[model samples]
Target: MMPMVLDWFIGNETCETIKTKSSDDVCQGDSTCYNVDNGSGYRCKCLDGYQGDPYLPNGCQDIDECKDPNLNKCEKICENTKGNYTCLCPKGYHGDGRTDGTGCVANQSGGSLIIELTVGLGIGITVLIAGSTWSYWAFKKWKLIKLKHKFFRQNGGLMLQQELSRRDSSTETAKIFSSEELETATNNYDESRIIGRGGYGTVYKGTLSDGRTVAIKKSQVVDESQIDQFINEVVVLSQINHRNVVKLLGCCLETEVPLLVYEFITNGTLFEHIHNKNKASSLTFETRLRIAAETAGVLSYLHSSASIPIIHRDVKSTNILLDDSYTAKVSDFGASRLVPLDQAGISTVVQGTLGYLDPEYLQTSQLTEKSDVYSFGVVLLELLTGQKALCFERLEEDRNLAMYFISALKEDRLVQILEKCVVDGAKIEMVEEIGSLARRCLRVKGEERPTMKEVAMELEGLRMMLEHHPWVNNDESRLEETEYLLGEASLKIGSNGGMNNVTYDSITDHIILQVGHGR
Candidate 1:
């Protein structure tokens, strides 16, 4: 259908008839009147560089077309006139400078130099130029090689080599990538390739030559003296092989800051699904529980199962990535630290996100596994309430979700604060159990919080109970059954790991409960 056009005119008669019969017209400065094809007799249009009704007094005002990119097709520099525009190329270039034309091309200064040399000198000039060019490139290549060596030594290349040499397993390794490889993979670090950004560094989405997609992180500049620390950290992180953890495939040390490459996660992040309006609608409570369990399990492995214990100093919903199948993949180890086997905790500068930081750790500067538990607790609250870790929009006391969540729980407002989707899908007791666990995790004292292993087991138990026995009613017998099944899961989770192979007899080996109405 044709769009509605609002045409203006002084009279129903044609422009020729109006002009011949009258001495003046409705058209004003720098405006002209034209016969309207519609029922209106005529319309006034500004000549150029103007907008608004041209029939009114002082309506046809000039506009700078150069101020807007779409208004001009200049390939180089654009200059606006009273009613038009002109394009001009910069120095050392020649062309019409209009995109519709030849645009701009570099002046052939090299040819001019060659011509001058040929006329003054002999044919030997050509050979001299060729030799000079070759030597120049050769010298530049040598300099680049020397610089690469300097960067390698400064970035702890030798230390990494020694650490790798100590490892006997060929399958367990982190590749040392060349700068060229990563640069090409991320198209020379183009802005469009960036997938995520944080205070630590920027992560780029890249495709390798082998058709493998990867997430490449280029870190900020580091102190050269602390090279051994980063190199050792890389070694420890590379040894961590967990399905729910984003694998560290390789790193590049030739640049000012190291570049780390990891397996690309298909789904964006747990935070996105939990908080994004469109995604949050479809994010079920069951999926949130599974993601929470998976994240907890990874943290447990990092703390206990790895060769060296690792404390994820930073943990939040954003760090919990999701795979194509919506499986959780815990990531962003920039703030992670390896805990020595002999020590229960380490003394370090306090570091963590605001709403997720353990209060004890923040005050004492003691890093521990419970710090991760605290952050994970904040993530749980986010999944539960679909709120950010910190929000200024809320009242001052209610700003921090962690404190506010516990406050809500204390006041028995759990149902009121929970995300509608979560409250809609889950039973009250199930939600209460998870909320209690999160409260324990978010205790002010790090020592008061349960170990990551215990937290993982609790979440796993809940998951298993849900899988084994679907809820029927909120009666006393059903609640007892739920409790018994959860207890059963706690005992057998180590062996079954929430797999489908759990048999009824095996799960109920010791616990005896009466069935039906019998005593």
Candidate 2:
């Protein structure tokens, strides 16, 4: 084709001095090209919003603003174009949808507005529910704290603190435990931890944080009228430091009823050992006498050795605990009374176990040290005969073991009434002496009963005599045979010629005859 040319360069040497250039050699697909110096050379420039090797095919692509919303300054939506992008509003909004400008706004008058209101209401409900749950828990915590404080004050916490503060620093005192500490220790007072229950309270076994095992007694009811007396008991128990008395470790008052913590005795009650058929066979006469002496020693200490005299109003076999070594530990001081130094006796309502109650105190309502003696005599009778202080299965006249024992002794039938196990183990003389001591203590008049000190001494003497004196024919096998024959033949024999039937004298003669014959 013929081309038209124009010459502007002075006299135009026919424009043959200018060089030719192709578009592909000068610029890329995404760039525009421009010639300089009459097509001698060219320059390339990328289009707006496109970058990265524009000279290569498929290199310079669309800049996707949606990938990074901040790049497009979009508030609601961003749509990418070939080489640029645009920002648009969402379905529920209206505006340019640019964060740098007037961004999306609520439509305010259609289905879009309804969608916005629904989302806002859901958020509000969630917040309200969370706030209500938090408040409920906080209120419960506050009420619990308030109740604990009320219980503490009602249980005479302030008085107990003052009493403890008045004592010397070196003096051993009981700990004042918090309710929470005890609750956690006992697993919220689980039923499995319960070791015993009585008329006064239920006892739980607990392990403290310091690893001490204790028995915690929780009273059945709270009596505001007896708060002072409860405090007094705490004080009195804390002062007692005897081996035979259970140790009062602490107390918890942050409950409606007070809780007392005591040293845990491993073995069961003396009643269990003395009454249970399986356990009774294992208790030797020496062990039984030692237990008796130890119990008597503790009562003596409570009556005379303690700083204040304590009258154990309820004395029974059930109240006597035994440790692993068979050491006696007197417990359940719920009905204990403190006697002033100047007072000879405390006149109060008669409260004690039925079978061990003192007839004199029961009649006069006068409680004294001698009343304890009477109760101890009942315990002695139990040890000697292995019979309960009161038994319904017995004949009417023999229902009361104390009266039955007295009647048997008066009729010289002590050998027949004595427990076969006790008779088999103890010498006849030792058993007779102990029975005599029990008879003296069981005297109906309080004045005639021996003091606890004298009782303790007498028991101790008997135990010493048993330990030292070697009775003749101490063989257990022979003793068992003698007891068996006595049980069988003595009943059939009549009180005819030489000796009365089943008397201590006759039993002694039978034993002598058995030993003489080497039977």
Which candidate wins on lDDT? 1
Candidate 1: deviation at residue 424, Å? 0.9
Runs off by more than 4 Å, candidate 2: 1-129, 410-412, 470-519
What would the TM-scores of all predictions be?
0.68, 0.69
Scored by TM-score, the top model is: 2
Clashing pairs in 2: none
Mind giving the per-residue lDDT tens digits that candidate 1 earns over 203-296? 9999999999999998775766667778988988887888899999878887778888999999998888988999998778878888888898
lDDT of 1 at 319: 89
Residue-by-residue lDDT tens digits, candidate 2, 1-519: 999877332222222322242323434567654444563444445677777665577556566767875667887788888777788997768888888889999876787767768999899999999999999989998998898889888998888988889989898988899998899888999999998988788999998999999999998876688798788789779878888889998799889898999998999899999999998887778888888888888888888888889999888898899998888899988788889999989888777888899999999999999999999999999999999999999989989999999999889999998877788787676687688779989999888887887777667755654564433345545444434544543322122211121211111122111111110
TM-score of the candidate numbered 2? 0.69
Q: Which residue ranges in model 1 land beyond 4 Å of their true spot?
A: 1-141, 223-225, 472-519
Note the Cα lDDT for every prediction shown.
0.81, 0.79
